[model samples]
Target: MAKPERHPRKTIPAASGPTNSAEEAKDGKDAGYNAGMAVFSYIIGGIIVWSLIGWGLDYLWGTRWIVLLGALLGAAGGFYLSHMHGLTRQGSSSGGSAADRGPSQDGAQ
Candidate 1:
């Protein structure tokens, strides 16, 4: 019969070399999750606030279309603001070197 192995295999990192890459991966995912949450919150918050304001205005003026108008404007404003402050900012920060930008489209060849 074959002899059993002696020492058990260790899971590494026990000697203080390089930590597992899983930690870094988890951190990146957490950051992305947080960013997503923030974006969602911004969109939801903007729309709700504006919609409420519009509803109040309609109640005061006894109008109906204003609410619809307000909701639409609120959605547009929310999306615009979210993209501007969240996606655009993050993209710019992580957008590698300036050379990554495509060549300018100026007419001067």
Candidate 2:
């Protein structure tokens, strides 16, 4: 005699309303934004510090261009460093591009 085939059973959770999920998703987005902003602020602060150092150097050497160059270099370095740090924290890339893992609530993929 042939044996009967058994079927796999699936289970679904009982939940109502979309509010809970929406709120949770929004919180996640907010957290990411806040983290990114914090990193950006730190970068700006670093740039300011560099500018101050450049100013001091200028004053000591009696040369304005040298100080200006230092300030510019510092700003560039700060921006690069901050961008990398921010991306790393967010678990993303510095390319500013996002890949869709699947459909989101907003129909974004």
The top-ranked prediction according to TM-score is 1
Model 2 lDDT per residue over 44-105, tens place: 77667788888898899887876667667776786777677654343554333344544456
Candidate with maximal lDDT: 1
lDDT of 1 at 20: 85
- Worst 10 contiguous positions by lDDT, candidate 1: 86-95
Q: Assess each prediction's global lDDT (C-alpha) against the native.
A: 0.76, 0.71
Worst 10 residues of 2 by lDDT: 88-97
* Cα-based lDDT at residue 83, candidate 2: 72
lDDT value for candidate 2? 0.71
In angstroms, how far off is 5's CA in candidate 1? 59
Q: Write one digit per residue (lDDT tens) for candidate 1, span 55-94.
A: 9999999998777777778778877887877553544554
Clashes of 2: 0
